[model samples]
Target chain A: MSRRTALAGAVAITALLLQVTVIDRLHLPAGRPDLALVCVVAFALVGGPTYGAVLGFGVGFLADIMPPADHTIGLLALAYAVVGYLAGLVEDVEERSVVTTVLMVGLASAVAVVVFAMIGALLGNAHISLSAVAHSLAATVIYDVVLAPFVVPLVSGAVRHAEPAG
Target chain B: MRDSRRARLVLALLLLTAFTLITLDFRSGGGGPFRTVGNTVFGPIERAVTAVTRPIGSFFASLGHLNSYKSDNAKLRAQNRKLLEELRTSDANRAHLLSLERLDHLAGQAQFRIVAARVVAIGNALDFEWTATIDAGSNDGVRRNQTVINGDGLVGKTLAVGPTTSTIRLGADPEFTAGARLAGTQESGFVDGGGHNPMTFTMLNTRAPLNVGDRLVTAGDTDNHDRPFVPEVPIGRITRVLPTPGQLYRKAVVAPFVDFTSIDIVGVVVAAPRTVPRDSLLPPSPSPTPTPGPGGTGGTGGTGQQSPPPSPGTTSGRRSTSPSPSRTP
Candidate 1:
């Protein structure tokens, strides 16, 4: 259990750092992938909803409060946690279809983006525009869908391997 | 039901924690414990990552285009030597002109004291426009509202000063504004940021004549009490003008000389030059051997030389925005 927690924390921290420093500068056609969000969703899919929520909150809070982050802290934490918890609830489903996985990630990413936008609006962040948010939401869903296949399996496999078996 | 009930309780608890953090962070305006801890823990790691990856990245990048780099290096070497000779001639001419301008007490030629800094990071993960982080901070004489500029023109103003770093809000940011005047003309106006579009400079008077391709520069009138920006720094060129019928003023789009996207190094105006007040009528008291002080040399030489980065932890003297009457330049 302790080893698993450490692995999760390390993955979360690495993803957060890369998201800000490396990923932000990539300047792809659509946008940068939300590696931090994807990391949380991956862990939750493997470790269950409770673990997902915990990881999302910790990682999101750190990312939000980091320097150069002008938004209100904890806004992403709530959004990511909700997304993670919901994604985790899908672990019990027997149908492990590709379409199901894509739909699940799509829904989770959309929820995260909209929640983040709504919270930003409520907090009176003038930079948030409904049209811009919708645009970003579309781009984010596409990017997350493409990234989910790699990030989810890698993180889940790593975490499960780190866990001590009976 | 029991398992679902536990999951619901967990979700509720996490939500409550998140909201509490938001309230605390909002009230403290980023001075809260969360931000402090986050910065303390992550700042060093970021510095390390940047330090390690930049050199490696550049090496591979250079290798990828070796033949092109070789060709460019040969061409640039000849050009560089020619430019160096021209620079020497210009430097001599500039010194003579500066002396005349000082003797005449030209407000537009006022010298300045500046601290040089390197841009360490660009936009955030969300791709927020017109903001960046620089290596210099309050520790290096950087303070909130100090104007930042590059070799080409004005970039932005320092937004917030951290202990070891500072955030700059670029000219393209929606919140940025500055007073501008047409080059070689007395027509003055205010320029407002237009985000993705070029900034709009509005002439205060409707009758003011504006022509396309006219240069714009900062209206750094100390007498008017403009905060932080040194007078007469280059801004940009007028690309297009909009004249509205019966409107009180005319607006033109200014294409800033500084390319906001590729900014690598910037200078912060730590102190304004000692200027003779514009209203003073007495003939400038001529001191024997008028040696231009540090402020004059540093400010005027900004475009001539790329200063070696300041040693870490070295800080310049802090000066108030109020123009000092010292005989230093």
Candidate 2:
């Protein structure tokens, strides 16, 4: 448990640093692949459903630190926790299907977006139209979907490493 | 029901947090968070960027060292000699230009030195106001009043300079105004900034022969020169000219040569070129020296100094809009 938490923190922090200093500059204008979200997703997948909630909290808290984010700071924490907790549902599947990975990340991404929008709505963050944000949402969904199949295995392999030497 | 109820509670809390964030953000417009995060988070990132760039810089330095190994010493010597000769020539040419302007404002010129600096920050357009940070400041002899300039024109003047950073107040800033002259005929005017509105250059009579493409240069401080100082350096070129009916002077829209927002590197004029009579700097030279002592003493000693010397009228120092005594074509 201790090892997993440290690994998750390190992986997530590295991705966060790169996202701000580099990926932020690479603003493809379409929504950027939320590397932090992906990292949280990966960690939660490996760490089990309940632990995924904890990882979500970490990632959500990270998002609050950026300049552009508005009120309802804890929305991310709650949203990510739920996303993580759900990832634990299929933790034991040995040979995860590519279709399954794609669907899970896609669904996860949609959930993340909806949660963010909902948070904004609650905060009365002037109702931004979904039409306006569709491109970013599309970009994120596509990126997360494409990344998941490759990422799940890597995440699983990392978790295997976390097991003690026989 | 129990699990659903807990999840709903969590969602409620999240919604509440979002509401609070919105209120804080709406009121602060990201100022508090940006500063806090900039220091805690972005500051480290900037430091890391510096660290990463430092290696590249050092590599370039070594590459420079390696390439210059053979000819560096000889090149330095030759460059030094050339610079010394060029300095002497510039000194003479500057004196000539000063003399021409001296025909207008006769006061001794203020000594200045030039230094080059690089831009570090360009303020965002969305929030506060636009400002730029230059790499040189007090450490480089840049001071508050000394202007920041690029090749095309004045970027702004130094507002504050630190050891490694300096903030420039752009010519377009509302607080800034400079005395300017129409280059073609050296007709003088005062230029004022009005935010995004077209900057204005107002002359007393509105009849100065201003034409499109006419350039403007820094007219030295009139307070110091009772007569408006002859323009020492070009600031910008006229883009639009408006001459009022029945007026003898006109105003023009000036497009500054320096793109204040995009400036990356600039040369600061260390000294305003002063063309004091050449004899003044030389000892016992040809130019008649003003005698020292309160009552202007000299051979004839009729109260020594020339009193009210050829009065041009009281100097009305241009307060940006200052209309002081001035002479030009």
Candidate 3:
């Protein structure tokens, strides 16, 4: 595997571990930020659509299988893959402005939350609530916007540095 | 153009992979290989992470509340002393009123071997979902569908069990339901989890006397051992009762005595048990007290003395009239 791919994989696993462990305990007023979501979005922005989609799958799969996860496996993987691919579309822009990047991350986070609930409802989870989706969307957007600036640029810089010479 | 084509191809492949996984997982029944693999690979890491992060989290939390600690400690100490004195007085009175006989009567009604477990994690990503993970699992004799409780009241039941961990769906989850009944009345019904709101209970009989603040307890029908809920466990108190004019049944909202959010230590009843029948099952019926005369005192003394003796041939009839305080509602 390419160094960039390997690094991304490592980061995804670490993000999953942190998401379920420490980040969960952080306990914000709205709710804890989705660390996996942030990482998926950040990496997607850095690596473009294909890389993001693949990374999102890895990360989502990790979450789906993790202990304490009661939902179906790959439900999150599907939701996040779509988010990563969509977020990666911003890479087509010639000059990706700060507002555009933040907005993209926010939008992706909201889409991920809604899509996840919709799919869960489809699978007979019976616990999905529109109000909960909306609340989670709002919280996710705010968290992503705050997190995107730091996470995306750092991941992008690291990936660029680790790029193999032609 | 080639880069875009390659990206599209990769995206398509990933989506297909995701779809295939979802289909396989759904078809294979809950959890499947993905869950086993995930737990095997990630459970230990998560546990270690928790061990490391907990101390740090507590440290920061302690730091944030350092200013209030001294005053709170002093206040708690004074409160503790006052509570100790109150407890002593209550203990003495309770000994006189509720004797060993009464204690045995209560013990006979609760028929389950319980294993205590500690809450290790709350559902975070799925905050809207009512779920938590406890430290004990199959290794500790914990099993799925076992009823979990705290001192105050019913918490929830075990949803899924891992090797060293098990997930509990809190009673506040929308999917949660338990058979329950009003304490003072034979009226039985099912209590449902409210999912962020107070739980709603629907009584089976329309004419069951409805009242606000009436306590509810489990109506343990263990006929279906698959759902082995013990009988007479206190659930909560009714906050509101809504009886529709045309409807045959009444529905009431219950406020659970146990605080779902703050639950720490909990007990899991491991098996369905039968309570030993009390010797004097029937205490008395709710009848008017006669005028306080010599005859009244004599009648009370007679009943009190004979209470412990098993009245012959009245077993079937007396079973229904037992008025043990613990059994009271």
Candidate 4:
């Protein structure tokens, strides 16, 4: 595998571990920030649609089967795969303004939550109430947006550093 | 253009695989081989991470609650003084004797055999489920469907058990439900977790007398094993009685006694009490006397003897029945 791909994979796994262990335990108001999702979006923005989609699937799969997760497996995988692909399509990552990138991250976070709830509903997961879904959607978007600036640039910089200069 | 097409093809294949995995997992009721393998591989790692980061996590937790520490300290000090005063009074002696009598009655009963465990990690942020992983597992005699409780009250039940770890579904999870009984009345119902909202208790008897502040305890199962919950474990107090003009069952909102967000140490009941503890396990009711003047205090001391002080960290002080002494003449 290419160095960039390997670095992205390593980054994604670290983000997943930190997300479940430290970030989720913080119990931040509204909702905890989704570091793994942010990392996936960052990688997608740096590498494009195909890379983002694959990374998202890998990360989401780990999340689904992770200890303490009782939900149907692949539910997160499906939601995040779509999110990664959509994020990668933001177009001209090098030319995009900071404001645009941050906005896109917020939008992606919101979409990931919504799609997760939607798929949860489809799979007969009764826990997905309308009000709960809406509350989490709002919380996830706000927290992720607040977190995007720090995470996105850091992840993108690392990926770029790993890129082979032409 | 060719690269984009190949990328799209890859996306399609990945999506297809995800869907297939979901189908296989859902059809298997989430107990597929993948789940077992994942637990075996990741459970220890997660446990270690939780152990290493707990101090850091608690540091931030305390930081969040820094504002409440002052008031809490003052309240505790006041309570200590009151308890000390009660100890000196002759009336308090009589009350203590009465509790001893009750304890005598419980002397021959079967005791709960519990496996104590520490919460190692919480559920992931992305999922809506409220669950926590405990460090004890099958090796520690922990099993699926065992009731998990802390000092305050019921926390949740074990969902899945690994060799060295187990996952518990907290009482706040929307999908969680447990049979509950009114403390004094013996009126039975089931409690449902409301996620971010208060738990709901629906009584089986449509016309059962319901009131605010009435406490609930686990009804437990008729079977001797008590597979999921033991009888008489405190659940919560009734918060709001929903107006049901023509409903078949009475519904009320309940605030659970345990703080699901901050669970630290919990015990899994491997063996239940021989005789149901009944309402004896519920926290002592708040003082009945509104104004414990010298004369009134003597008379009310007997009532205090009936129940022991509330368990530490129960937050029952706020729900005391009597108005604060400062407010009384």
TM-score of each: 0.69, 0.44, 0.73, 0.80
Model 1 stretches astray by more than 4 angstroms: A164-166, B1-3, B30-33, B56-110, B175-214, B219-228, B240-254, B274-329
Model 2 TM-score relative to the real fold: 0.44
Give model 3's docking category. Answer: acceptable
| Weakest ten-residue segment in model 4 chain B by summed lDDT | B289-298
Tens-digit per-residue lDDT, A28-123, candidate 3: 566556777878888787677887888888888878887767677887898888888888877657688888888888888888888788878887
Q: Retained native contacts per candidate, as fractions?
A: 0.39, 0.06, 0.54, 0.66
Q: Estimate candidate 3's alpha-carbon lDDT, on a 0 to 1 scale.
A: 0.67
Candidates sorted by TM-score, descending order? 4, 3, 1, 2
Give the candidate order by descending lDDT: 4, 3, 1, 2
Tell me, what's the RMSD of every candidate? Answer: 15.4, 15.4, 11.5, 11.6
Clashing pairs in 1: none
Instruction: Spell out the clash pairs found in candidate 4.
Output: none
Per-residue lDDT over B216-240 for candidate 3, one digit per residue giving the tens place of the 0 to 100 score:
7777665754254666667887789
Interface RMSD of each: 3.1, 8.9, 2.8, 2.3
Q: After superposing candidate 4, which stretches have Cα over 4 Å from the reference?
A: A164-166, B1-3, B56-110, B124-127, B287-329
- Distance from true location, Cα of B129 in model 4, Å: 1.5
C-alpha lDDT score of every prediction, in listed order: 0.65, 0.52, 0.67, 0.74
Screening candidate 3 with a backbone cut-off below 3 angstroms (N, C-alpha, C), the clashing residue pairs are: B183-B329
Worst 10 residues of 1 chain B by lDDT: B61-70
B129-218: candidate 4 lDDT, tens digit per residue: 888887777777778899887666788999878877788899999889999998866779999988878899999877557878889988
